[model samples]
Target: MNGTNKGGAAPGRGGGLASPRFAAVMASQALSLLGMEILQFVLPLHLLNLTGSGALYGGVIAAGFVPYTLLAPIGGVIADRTRKRGVMIAVDAVLAIAMAAYLFAAGTSAVIAATVAVLMLAFAAQALYQPCVQSAIPHLVESHEVERAVALVNQVGMLTGIGGPVAGGIAFGFLGLAPIVFISAACFAASALVVAALVHVPYEPPARTAGAVATARADLKEALAFLRSRPLMWRTIMAATLVNLFGSSFFNVCSPYIVTETLGLPNQLMGVLQGALAVGGLAGGAIVAAVPGTLGIRRVPALLLGVVAGIAAIACVLMVPLPALGTYTALVILYLPTMAVCMCMSIVATSYLQVESPGTLVGKVMALAIMLANCVTPAGQLAYGVALDIVPAWAIALVAASVTAAVAWWLARAER
Candidate 1:
């Protein structure tokens, strides 16, 4: 039901994402993502390089997520109430300004605190902004087109994952970090203008008199009630949350540990492993997009749980000292399947979540699901670190895998 055309762009003539608005937004996404990824790549590396303390760097990085998790639900509520196009435009503009602020903090400690604050705000803006874009997809296309649409949307990110970092690295190597930041700023600003001129879809705006806090609260309550009514979807969300909490935690804390401490490998190898996962994610998103209707709601939990199991297997293999296979080989063998499985899980699961709900509730529901799923990530990462000191890395992985398996099994049974 391609609804109303508010701003510009003709309605897509066919069900195959024929809307010019979709193309416009996708173009905006590409530019915006290219900017964001460069900054995301450059920032942590800069921090790590400057501090030379992983603890300090990780702590600073973790701190940014605090606002993201808390503000994401509010963002969802706003998306439901306002035109998503405007929300995206505003967020992008502000992010561009934030990047400019970081430029001031680029060389010296003069406004180090300000730079960090700006970075935190930028991260929060991103977390908030994502729900709006995701919620906008169904409004732009017919119901049957959602899977392909979401997959196509996801491809923007996948493409950025491949291009952004490499370009960021090249920029950093040749022109330095400041130039990359400047380019990022320009990208967001350009994206704002593109989206402002193009996206057109009608959504019900909430009452202006109600304060944002109250509106957000009401929106979240409604989303929770919807979750209460849908058993399978709720289970998928919860299972996904548990996996996000521990699975990412393991990687954030334990993967490096496995690579550096346990595997006794160089630091560069870690980058290789991360690149592998990014490539794997790109491959997975393309697969989902190409296969159109494969993402049934009931099938999602199994796929996710299977991914978790793959992580467990990868963890177990890392513990072993293979005779002929080198560290790189073992990493390739263990990492590929786990990353690929998770990639498939993410492609199927998130697309299902975004398009399955009613448009009115989609934004808030998407935000709440993403926030709840990700809220514990930082703390879980810290906990994994602490746990590693008390227990061993291999021991921790075994427990994590078992817990993940149990959750997956429970989800599977619930779905049946």
Candidate 2:
């Protein structure tokens, strides 16, 4: 499937960040992710204001992930078959148009429905878009630089994420949703241009003997057969799935509720915490990029244990008698490091998968692995959403920590 490289060296043998094509892809992703992250932060706040129901807020968030989970495998097929640059350019353009259309419809009675619909579309696009990007990484960089490239990719999103929520919150606070939507649309539009003009992905036509549907099925079966032979990959996927369920989903659902409702913090502070989450990810990606081999798959269990400790600490913080600002401060301090650990674990798992899979199978294999790991996230979101209504934040934290601890245990046993 490899083609002669343009504006860079051949696939998997040359080009680090110095390559023009690699830099262009990074730039495009940065803009696209900035837009997406801004909306990601803004939408929940909008829904929370409109409904004031944790269950509804959580449901809307989970609804977005539903399509993401379902469409990921299809995305893998598209990525493996088509030109990645075209896919990136097209998806960003579509997202820009969707946001622009939604801007005008914001004043209508259909605002809530429109919001959910637009968000789901965005999430769906992300499911289709990301596999192309992830699969392309190995093709763009030398084999040894794959981890750094992956870290760089993760960092771009995390970097934008750090500013997106804070900027979105401030914009929403003062200018309302229209301006944020406009900015997001502009960012996506810019991303499309960047990818179309500069990003270069080596491509070769995939051979097909059957119809499209049959081909897709066969491709998926090939991927599954490959995975079935790799028990370590399955174990890794299982451990990652548990972490996503208990660790990430808990914060995703509980953070807004705890910050806004339980702690009575302002909307702006919520934005800060969200940005802090990104900061953690940014830091984690930096660590991996700087020292790619320092933390290997063997260390993942310890990282998961670190996440357990972080969640348990959150429970203790909630139990403490502190002022609202103090509690918020404690959370930011605690969450930043904890999220960094989670990010490291995620990068390690992804880097391992990328290294293990062959280039031809990378897209489908990554998609399947990611789908299995991510499939539980929506369920966890919904479960925690409902749990927040009846359970204390402290108790929920403790339970989440306990569940994640079990996952860590399983991971350690498997690794041993």
Best candidate (score: TM-score): 2
Whole-model lDDT, model 2: 0.86
True-vs-predicted CA distance for residue 226, candidate 2, Å: 1.2
TM-score for all predictions?
0.84, 0.96
Q: Give one digit per residue, the lDDT tens place, for model 1 in 45-130.
A: 56655654445444555666678888888888877887888888998999898888887777777544654576578778887778
Residue-wise C-alpha lDDT for candidate 2, range 1-416, written one tens digit per residue? 01222222345565777798789889999999999998777877787867677887788888888888898899899999999988898999999999999987788888888888988999999988899988888788887777888888999989898889888887787788899999999999999999988998888887999999999999999988988898878888888888788778888889988988888777778888999999999999988888878898888889989999999999999999899889999999998999899889888888888777777878888888878888989888888888888888888899899999998898888767
Q: Quote the lDDT for 139 in model 1.
A: 72
Candidate 1, residue 83: the lDDT equals 80
lDDT against the true structure, per candidate, is 0.70, 0.86
Model 1, position 88, has a per-residue lDDT of 86
**What RMSD does each model have against the real structure?**
4.4, 3.1
Instruction: Please give the TM-score that candidate 2 achieves against the real structure.
Output: 0.96
